[model samples]
Target: MGIVLHLKKKEMACVEYSFHVPSLEELVVVLQKGLKGNFADVQVSVVDCPDLTKEPFTFPVKGICGKTRIAEVGGVPYLLPLVNKEKVYDLNKIAKEIKLPGAFILGAGAGPFQTLGFNAEFMPVIQIGSEHKPAMNGSYFAHINPADGGCLLEKYSEKYHDFGCALLANLFASEGQPGKVIEVKAKRRTGKLNFVTCMRQTLEKHYGDKPVGMGGTFVIEKGKAKTHIMPAEFSSCPLNSDEEVNKWLHFYEMRAPLVCLPVFVSKDPGFDLRLEHTHCFSHHGEGGHYHQDTTPDTVEYLGYFLPAEFLYRIDQPKETHLFGRD
Candidate 1:
């Protein structure tokens, strides 16, 4: 008798877009439209948006994302989905006796895949060094301090090496400080190296923040906090071609201290990854398997390099997630 192999498709993570209705009367219309579009289990809730002018953060609305301050309006519901906010997961849970006022929000979350795809096509610009720390555009809620309501994203500074909260100052309007810093424990999966899974695992340590998508140029997980010497020749270095770029990077590998490699991703699953270290190139998936000799900086198979125009901050990847806010 032949053996029947019953195969089950893997339940890969999925993301989708959310919608906004102007009034309670529009809820049914939106829900009917969504169901027609094949979306299931439509849910609704109330949320209040902060007045950026009044609430204090260099960027106030950014302090709240994902985890909504769910509110109810006259027995109706709404939601403020800030998919753009940087989140560490945990948002303060308002007391049961408390209630929120109705706020305006047009749309909800989109598959980070869709979101990042949009970013790659339209907005691929990123900054080097802490000058504006453009990589950190997410809301400050990810770095909120539980003890004192401190937010770290508002205070990262390259000058004092304050890295947001290098001064260990208050993040929120409270008086308490971070109770203590504790390192999160990590365990690697056996066999194949899964970069996305690994990154997601580390981020899971934080209560509220989770990755929706990655595109263009980004750092998944900061490898080290220490900065290595950037070659003086780097200023004049041209990353014009793979060959030229490889030589410049080779100069660092043999002498310079270890630096963080900025990773790039594409929508295509095949050539979806790139690691531009000592001559990096695109890989099939997750930069392929981590070979015994494979180093963090090398993303390509042939060891080619990317030109300088594509290079991100070569100084050091942003290791500190949240810093003390002013």
Candidate 2:
């Protein structure tokens, strides 16, 4: 005998889901998974407690060349058209034009005409010749290409120069200001790990919903590492075909003790801002744009980062064909 009962239908209701804050171990696991099984023993810890603002002042520009716009950040003038096509730039002159009593600036871009010999001390330059080659400070001028490599030139007189090239960089200038400090360390392991990706994920999880910008130096404590260099200088438009451009991308594997300058953003600011950008210049006379560690049982990374209260995005292209996307 079967018993039948009247049943009432229920309506489904939407529920908001809150993401749980991940612990350090949990965050490490997530980062390991993101590395696709390439694991590196990771450790993350806050070093200093600084009174840092939750929100940072953002200054964004769409294009640099062809426009006569000069913006000042912290009383430092940032002229966009100074590094346009067919334009000559003197690093000493630029420093004089933008120098403040006490300030610091950090950005990346292309510069120094490859064909013309310029007296400048810059390294890890990637330019296209018969083949893609990674050029360093002492030997950069030897490799002559119509276009130069993307580089970070500071406003210091120790390394100054004039160049006929174009650039797009965010110059952060400010007096002494405190920023939140964090330190990350990874021990030698058998597999590779993407340092930038790991740092980005960790920062995002740490900061939660708030966007943050960080700049600091990192060192490849030991073992072999890998980095890439842009084979051709960047412009508002492409100078080579997609196929050729792809061929021009070059990577280098080098020994340890490579010091790097990392400029990272925790969240996209709705502008054409790179979430993570790092460039390395080593005292061993080898450096370039950092990629990942590729050493087996001998790879280590030790880095300290400080979150900034301001981020200036300069010279964004109106329509960029970068990476073959419009």
Candidate 3:
């Protein structure tokens, strides 16, 4: 029998069905079956445990200014620099130097070579920076960039000479806590945007102010998107207008399998939080900052999501105009 939860906030009511899984392996098996188009959407959210005093993982969102040790991985300190025209740190080197254990460290940021201009998705399994790039035959090619760095797309590598990135990262240690599994299935054919929106709305209505961290693989049966690659350099005063940034972005019509990692929080956590930030990587070598999904119909997404216990904001920029935000 499934446990039913009635969550209400601001007069809005949301109902959720909770399931208990014996292990992570079992969760993967369920998600894999969903990917075969058995379900339009499948999500496993972590259950809230009031008795647990410590969070399962920590997320370091926004700008990375190497000076701060926002979090740690395997007892090693993790740092991100304030990258700009005057500064460019070797992300690969940084990952290697950390000497993290064999664990999952997922993030999205600007890089490879900032000057070349490109966005990156990192899925490094510690000690083996597995960077995936686009290969010739509609497939992805894997390489070791040492310390498992982020994968940069060649399609977006344009020479702009001015670029900077406020990277968002999360570190999940091997011994992190696990929560109850909340699986959400779509009743009809849905687009990625709507599917994601449903997932977020459901979480918000049910979980209310509690923050949730969701990560896992999802297959995009029919994909359509707009992606961006960062410029190589940036001025102290950078362009923030949508018209200006649009120049660096490109459109695509894709059909591929992808992985998505996102965090959802209904209420502000007293920090500079994006609230909803998601990045995706695919085996087709087609990925960047996922602006949106324009796929019309028959767009299916199957994923397994888990809630995060804590969030750590790091190196938040004092100036909002740098990215054109007032």
Q: What is the C-alpha RMSD of each candidate to the true structure, in Å?
A: 22.5, 16.9, 14.0
TM-score for each of the candidates: 0.21, 0.56, 0.52
The positional error of residue 83 in candidate 2, measured at the CA in angstroms, is: 11
1 versus 3: better TM-score goes to? 3
Give a tens-digit lDDT track for model 1, residues 266-318: 11121111221111111110111111222334221110011111111111112
How does model 2 fare in lDDT?
0.42
Global Cα lDDT for candidate 1: 0.18
Clashing pairs in 2: 62-316
Q: What are the runs in model 2 whose C-alpha is more than 4 Å off?
A: 1-40, 48-101, 114-166, 170-180, 189-193, 205-209, 231-244, 322-326
Please write out the lDDT profile of model 2 over residues 1-326, one tens digit for every residue: 11122223531111111122334344445444543334456666655522222211111111111101111111101112112343333322332233322233333333354434332223322111112222112112211123544333232223533322233332322332343335667675544336766566655766666655555556787887776555443333433444654454455686778766566666654445556666666545465656677875777777655555444333334544334210
- The per-model lDDT (C-alpha) reads 0.18, 0.42, 0.35
Native RMSD of candidate 2 (Å) = 16.9
Kindly indicate the candidate among 1 and 3 with the higher lDDT: 3
